[model samples]
Target: MDSRVVNKGQLPELLDKLARDHTLIAPVREEENVTLFKKVSGASEVQLDYITSDVSPKGCIFPQTEKTISYTYTGDTLEMKEQDEPPKTVLFGVRPCDINSILALDPVFEGKFLDTYYLEKRKNTVIIGLSCSTILSTCFCTAFNSGPCDGKGADLMFTELGDKYYVEVNTEKGSSLVEAYSQYFSKGDTDKLAKAKEEQAKKLEGQFRRKVDLEGVKQVLDENFELPYWDKVFKKCLGCGICTYVCPTCHCFDIFDYVTGEFTGDRFRCWDSCMFPDFTLMAGGHNPRPSRKERVRNRFMHKLKYHLDRYNLDGCVGCGRCISKCPVNIDITQIIKDLKEVGQNA
Candidate 1:
């Protein structure tokens, strides 16, 4: 990856230039106390200091309600309309955790049946990730072999230093963008850039107050299915499902059709949380994991164990949205720390 430095106070103009060539989407605080990744006409709207947002950036690509196709019933024949164009855009200011979740989700969406909707949007977009300097008590990216500096899913990465930003071009698309937008940047200076990067790296690599013991986390969680800690830990859970809805890595969802009067609209899928008792309810009036303890157990187990078995990677990126968002104040890092089998910090 080629690295360079952009001059101070020019990010907005650079974003405008990028928006001219591509659809730029960055974090914008729309309403009071809400941040969303939306189309950026200019960089002035981007909120770089925001650590966590109410809505996950995943919704930008995987919309809450997407019309797969339109169909109208005509007694004899039916007409169906399929999408003609693919989505072309750029997702910028992505955090390392959110970016890794996108990559982790690649196998799920593109693994067996190619989710044309997701793939089309993915293929057309470029991810520009930024190093995380702010971390909440719940952040545990280190557990998943990721950090603020991990560039796993980003085509381009940005690290803040003083008032300027250090850019790393990770892919050919990113390299070309840097080359194309050379006017906004200055020649790279190795010494200052190195010192700046080291400063950023130090915060990402060492500032975290909390992290998980991940080596045997999967194995320990797998073998401790019968652990009695679940009941005690989730005793206060109201099961409102807000945690998963805000989580960037929690991807469980359900698809169903909505009918109005004589006809049905397109099939739709919305974010679903495992914390809900009805989330796993089976047919014939039976639910295997019916208790709150089970629901709580499943959330952690899926993040630390099931995802590793299914995707060869841990499901959690530890963005801390779940921690700050949970109404009951249940913290996952505290749960992991209390786990009997997961080795304690040295």
Candidate 2:
């Protein structure tokens, strides 16, 4: 757990070095109100002051659309080709909640059935997490025992401590990268800077305006699978799927083939959402989740109970992108609070 200090002025040079060595992905402001994680060449392309990107950087690992294999068949001959290996990558400026989301996803891709597509990118990438300095109205990471500065799953964590960046090397991958670029880091006793980061985390915790409690909410969802609560929430849902798209933990996808010619095609996988009606449709055209009520119930149930039941980890990380992006103002925190109230009444 060695820590080092780097002047804010040297960040550009550090980014330049990393970009030259690996594929660099960081947050960049596309417009006044929009910030998205994109491939960057240096610090000039990175938005270092953003609270959160509009979209999670999860796409870097499990892409929205990916070609799994290409195939061609002519007469009696057939040929198939798999995709290339992912390049060495540096995922920079990830928030702690997003880091937690990646951990939540790890089991889904790594258990009895391993997803090599995701595993390859994960194996070749180095995660450089950034500590959150400010709190948004929707943020409630504290409810999950995660804070703005928690670096639980990161290889390296960078906290902006006034004029300098306090870098904590948490893994061998991080240590090797730091050792390789020793010129950017300054030798120092990082105790004072680490303390400052803690103080910053505490201050930001109190600044959170939302109080999200999950004490008995999961139990309620587990007991009452068919509730009048589904009727209330689903009425307002537009089935837009924005929540799943912005969510860091939602990982449903569909696979099919795209025909290129008479004897050629490529098999691809793309993101799918349980919020959509077709998500549960069978090949016979019978949909288990036939209405918005069932779909909406399933979505929240998956978040509150199912994922935790399967993975022993909280499915929702309280990042609040779903809350902020929902056109009808459907909030997961509000849902948890309401569910707790429902449980108390029952």
Candidate 3:
């Protein structure tokens, strides 16, 4: 429960030190408007001023494309090889919404069927969550009982307090790191700093422009899976899979083999989306979700109802990446609002 303070100027030094010890992944401005989480060697590469990265930091745990296994054929004999071990990693500057998304993902990969590829990386990485200073019009983390300074899944959390950062160690891993770098962190006035952090969180909470109401959304979907709502919502969808790709919680994927020659090949697992027509298509030419209506309905149902049914967790974290990236303006906030209206009428 002990908290420490780090002067704003000392952050870069801390990041540099962590990078030297572990694989440090943080937000980097790749281009003018594009920011993504990438492995950095030092603090000079980190972009701490960004609102949010264009892509979620989930890639650090679950890579977009990974070779699960490799094989080689020699005459009549065959050999197989597993992928190498994941590195010890430090994921820095993850926002609360994305951190919540990582919580939602834990059960999925750690449940009945264990995904070692994801589990290995998750086990090795330590997360350092950063509190949001600015709330965008699309953000709705409050709907999920989270806000800018929420630190539910992080090992450590950092909240900006003017010229310094109020650092709270949330887990043993975080405590270990703090102990290792004792020189950089100093004990601060806990009561006063906690009050200031709370005030800052409240101020950011009021800045969210999106008001999302989830009451009866799952119940409505449970009762009315074949509603006319699907027909209307699917019409505008381009099936580009932008929403799923940008979503922090969307975890659908596909696995296949690629041959480099007749004798050598690799098996890969890549991210897939339900919005794609082939996602639910079977080998016998049977497509369960044959049209945009069915696919669109399935996507929302997965976010609002199905995932919760399976994992007992909210599938969507309300990060608003899907809202900002959708070319057709098919807003999830609008869908939730409309679903509430439907529930009331019924």
Candidate 4:
């Protein structure tokens, strides 16, 4: 409940204060055309105005590769070293879609058996979701019931209002944050906050020019699985996996051990995509999802249908990164749109 207007000029000092108690991680401009979230010392480096980051914040939650443990060999015994660098993190300027992805994955990782590594970090990290003043054509968080200034996953949500920033502290962590850094903020009137939130919502929602009926996607896509649509849509599907790697919600991963002449490595997991041909291949080379059509079809089916059945939530938040970054320009939302048409005809 602790909330107030933080003077724009004092943002860096506020970040400096937070960094004292935790490892501050925020979005930083890597180069002219690229931006990525990294460990930051000050808030001045946060590029909050960037349209969209080149990579998603999934790496912050579900890392690309992590060593579960390391082992040392003695003459007759092996000792293990557990990696528990699950330090508290401040994920600043996280986009709505990226934050929702983490929230959505909560049930998956915490459902059957709690993944200690992910859980520890998830519990410790405090999200500061920034409003997307401008939505990229690739952005579609609205389709998933989340908006630009959404306070869904953020401990503290910040929305810019001309010369000042409007703050909404939604959780205990956020309340603590507001209390900890009271000097930077002011008690602002309702008129500014009310108008600021409304204006940002209206503008960002319009920026998502492309729209879809989120409710209709699951049934349409699942029922039309065997249709000849996959071959036609993924006609030029080259099977490269750049789409999933860049996706904010694509969480499939693979575990492997690297053995070399110098050292014996521990088991590590890396990001994996279903688009790869070898992904479905078995030991005897007997593959289930053999063709390119199957591979492409499986990708969509898993996103819309399988995940819905499993988690009762849409796996794809309509971030549309796959469509923008796909080598073949395969729009997942467009695919769902076409499937809805097919259902109407049938």
Candidate 5:
């Protein structure tokens, strides 16, 4: 619960120091209007001004294409190898919405089936969440009990205040990091800074254009799985899978073998989307979700109902990446609003 202030001028030095000791993953300006979280050697590579990255930083923990196991066979002799150890990592400048999205993902990978690939990276990484300075029109983190400055899943949270960053150490990992780099961070009046951070959070909370209400929405989905709303909602969907790809919480994946030679190959798992037509396609050409309607329905159901039922966590973190990216504007906020209306009418 200790707080510190890092002068804006010294932030680069701090990041460079951390980079030398750990794998620094932060947002970088790849091109015009494109920002991504990549491994940076120093603070010079980090883009501190972006509203949000084009894609979620979930790739830092769970990669898009990960080889789980490699196998080699020669004359009935088989050799298998697992993935290498994950590096000590520092994920910096992630917004609260994306931070909560990681919380949504934690259960899925750490459930009955212990995913070592994701867990290892998760264990080794320290998240330094940055409070959002600009709230986009598509943002709706408040609907899911999170906000621009919420620090639920972060190890440390940084709130930019003019020439300095108000740093809140929230975990042991964060405390250790701060202690290691004590020179960069100076002691501030914790009481005043905390009050200022709260005021700032409240101010940013008011800027959200999207007013999302989840009241009775999940219950509606639970009661009426065959609602007529699905018929209308799916009509506009192109089944492009863009929403799932941009979503930080979406964990659906497919596993297959990649052959290197006649008797050697690696078994890989790549991110898959429920929006795709073949997501539920079976071996005998029988697809459970044959059309866009079912696929679309399943996607929302998982977000609003099924995931919570199974994991006791909200599947969607209301990051609004899906809202911004969806070509036809298949908004989750709109869907929730519609579902609530349907529930009332029923």
Candidate 6:
């Protein structure tokens, strides 16, 4: 709950210090128009000029594939070993929408049934959020009341203002980092800089091309299990599962064991998707979501209604990864607008 400023010129030094002290996960541009969050080798590997990474950095916590338990069988006895503790990590350069998505995932993994694997990594990681200087045509985080510079869930948030970066220390973890690197920071007129950050957020907010309204959409979804609207929507769906795969908030996963030897095996969980036809296939050879229409309906309903019903949080963070990456151009913002229409007519 304190503020400081760091010169943009000394950013590399700060990054280098973080890399030396902690496991740094930051965005790196791999090729033309391709950016991803990768384990940083040093400050030179971190890319700061991108609008958004191609994929959300959720893997840092909930990896796409993770070993949960390894077991050894001997006669009538069995022994199992759980995963080791995660390292002290720094998740840097995360955006507001992606940060919110992590919050949505927090309750899913920590409440009632505890996922120690996800929880341990989440606890050990310090999130450094970055303010967006620009907006994309598909970006709609504002619809969920999350703006470009919103920093509700970040440990530390950075807003670029001309010559220096306005740093908001949001938690003790972030404060510790700032304290450790006190030489790189100065207690500038943060109140005025805070106002400048607000003005920057406001200007970027107006630039978002997609305007989404969730007003009565959830109510409609709650009342109806089946919709003719889904029939038309599912037509172009290829059942490729790309939307669910790239989503920051989608948490569906499948667990299986890999046998390394006759008496040993490792149980692992990997990301799964509702868009896949075989996702809900029962071993008895019947699938509840048997077709593209039903699968597509479930995907949208889960994003719009099911998650809200269960967690009281918006499942989709409006990061627009699905919109940008969908091969057939299936857009969730348009779906929300159409669903709002359906609710109105109902």
Which runs in model 5 stand beyond 4 Å of their true positions?
Answer: none
Candidate 2 accuracy as lDDT? 0.93
Candidate achieving higher lDDT, 1 or 4: 4
Over the stretch 1-346, how does candidate 2's per-residue lDDT look in tens digits?
8888988889999998899899999999996668888889888999988997899999999999999999999789889998899999999999999999999999999989999999999999999999998899889888887999998899999999888999999999999889999998876759999899889988888899998889999999989999998899999999999999999999999999999999999999999999999899999999999999999899899889999999999899999999999999999998999999999999
Residue pairs of candidate 1 with colliding backbone atoms: none
Question: Which residue pairs in candidate 4 have backbone atoms (N, alpha carbon, C) closer than 3 angstroms, thus clashing?
Answer: none
Q: Distance (Å) between predicted and true CA of 328, model 3?
A: 0.4
| Candidate 4 structure quality by residue, lDDT tens digits, 1-346 | 5557877777778888777778888888886677787888776677778766778888888888887776666657766777776888888888778888887788877888888778888888989888778877767778788888787878988887877778878898888777777787778774668676887798778878787775666777766768877779778888899888888878888888665323445768888989998898899989998888898888888888887798887788867778888887888878878887778777
TM-score of each: 0.91, 0.98, 0.98, 0.93, 0.98, 0.98
- Residues 39-79, candidate 6: write the lDDT tens digits: 99788999898897898899899999999999999989999
Off by over 4 Å in 1: 190-192, 260-264, 340-346
Per-residue lDDT over 1-346 for candidate 3, one digit per residue giving the tens place of the 0 to 100 score = 7688988899999999999999999999996679999999999999998897799999889999999999999988899999889998999999999999999999999999999999999989999999999998989999998998998899999999988889899899999999999988888676788899999999888888998989999999999978988889999999999899999998988999999898999999989999999999999999999999999999999999998999999999989999999999999899999999999998
82-169, model 5: which lDDT tens digit per residue?
A: 9999999999999998999999999998989999999999999999999999989888999999999998889999999878889999
- Worst 10 contiguous positions by lDDT, candidate 3: 184-193
lDDT of 6 at 226: 84
Candidate 1 C-alpha lDDT tens digits along 1-346: 5777887688888888888788889988976769878888878888888776667788777776676776667777766776656656888999888998887777778877898888888888889888877776677787777887777778888888878788877898777777788887666684688677877777667778885665555566766688767778779888888887888777777787665437535656777788887888988879988898899888888877888899887688788888888899988777776773544431
Cα-based lDDT at residue 76, candidate 6: 96
Would you list the C-alpha lDDT of every candidate in the order shown?
0.78, 0.93, 0.93, 0.80, 0.92, 0.93
Q: Give the residue spans of candidate 4 off by over 4 A.
A: 73-77, 260-264
Q: Which residue pairs collide in model 2, if any?
A: none
Model 6 misplacement above 4 A = none
Candidate 2, which segments miss by more than 4 Å at Cα?
none
